[model samples]
Target: MTPDTTAPTLALLLVDLQNAYFEAPALAGVRESLIERANELVRAARAAGRPVVLVRTEHARDRSTWTINMRADGEGFAFRGTEQAAYVSTLERAGAIDVVKTRDDAFHGTRLREVLSGLGVSQLLIGGVSTHSCVAETAMAAFAHDYRVAIAGEAVASENGSLAAAMLDFLTEELRQPVLDHAASLRLLQGPLDAR
Candidate 1:
């Protein structure tokens, strides 16, 4: 389908592109190329006048919840307000809605739904790190909430490529959401949000 150029009030949802995820030794093979692609998407979203939402993963100083269910090697990795929790430098911090999430899903216990609802945003464009976990969960949650969801495939990454591919495929085919490449997402943002 062609992109709508009517300036659809889209919201760019950046999930967990923080410093910790990038520097973690456990995530060694994740290509730096994904960060570049995600930055491009952020640029396009801003140029198109869409609202950008940066979701950061933060854990309490105690790190009780984050440590649970995590591998011992990656335990206590995302402490709140630490350098590890900050957004990457390549992405612009100004003019973006910044929110802190304690869990995998950004919407849980956060003002995300309220913020988007207040903005009258009917569609959500999502991209970020850990495609199989936080990113995938957020995309599906948006769709389930009845918002049109689009995920930039190239703008997301995981510890492994196979898991990323599987999550993208499931979201596109089973969930029936649009899993576009970075270029396609940019084109869509340029067009009207109402365009199919």
Candidate 2:
């Protein structure tokens, strides 16, 4: 008998790289670097013939789809027709599969899991904004769904740096996942899914 290996099935998941977060003055500093790093993953994924999934947050203006916090605040960002909901102009989004999520967890109320399943994506190399919220929740949900997960540290931004650090630590240490840098993530796409 011989050890059999399955072909690597990986997708690059880019989340919440929309104007809603990046346009915020408080997050402006991270916008440029984060998008650049994430776009690196996007380009590598495309060159490697891997699927790139865009997970973005959007809401309805009628208050029907607003979260509790949004409702309480009597306002919302990223409403469907708003420019805030649109992906940033610099992001590499051509030919990517799009999934709209209303909550922090991309898989919770969206077709993200099904999209991944349909694409036969057994592993995910994740990048994007708000590392402590949408990014963290999506990673945790992917873990729960038994998908191997990796994060590109520089590609994920947050309103709070400390919280982002904590979430990365939890994902790397507690969840036994890899938190990779931009170069390493490109290598992972070029070679094996488990490559460091």
Candidate 3:
């Protein structure tokens, strides 16, 4: 089944488009294109007077906030106030609501829901990096929260094509969520949001 597209309000949720994630070699090939597509979504959202929420992952410097495996791996993640944790330079962030998250799900311990509620956003268009992890988790959480969710197919990317494809299949085929391309997303987001 296709996602029900009728909603009174909608917003765009951009997951983990930070410098650190973009710098990973695994994401290098698709990074530029993904950002471009995301920019298009941002532009469309702005034109339609919808909120564009920017969600990034940032933990404490001492790694105290890190998850068990992450801490065990001895690798520092997006530490707060660090350049590595900053949003990538290319994408437009002005007027966007910034949400700092410590976990994969953007809603966990974050004001994302509150922000959406304030905007009367009953539907969310999600796209960003690591298709199998953070993006997938956020999609599930949004669905559970009773918000209509759609994934921007071309705007999100993973470390590998296989992982991206797998997540897309699960979300679209298994879960029956809508997976829209950048152009389709633009039309959906920019069009009238009054429920049909």
For model 3, the local distance difference test gives: 0.85
| Pairs that collide, model 1 | 4-191, 4-192, 5-191, 5-192, 6-192, 8-193
Q: Which residue ranges in model 3 land beyond 4 Å of their true spot?
A: 1-8
Pairs in steric clash, model 3? none
lDDT of 3 by residue, 29-138 (tens): 77888888899899999988888999999999787778878888988778888887999889899999999898889999998888777777788899998898899989
Residue 105, model 3: lDDT of: 92
Clashes of each: 6, 0, 0
What TM-score does each of the candidates earn? Answer: 0.86, 0.92, 0.91
Model 1 stretches with alpha carbons more than 4 Å out: 1-8, 25-32, 64-67, 70-74, 193-196
Candidate 3 clash figure, as a count: 0
Give lDDT per model, in order: 0.78, 0.85, 0.85
Q: What's the CA error at residue 3 for candidate 2, in Å? A: 22
lDDT of 1 by residue, 28-122 (tens): 45546766777777788788788889998888766565645664556676777678878777766678889888777888889898887776777
The superposed Cα distance between candidate 3 and the true structure at residue 155, in angstroms, equals 0.3
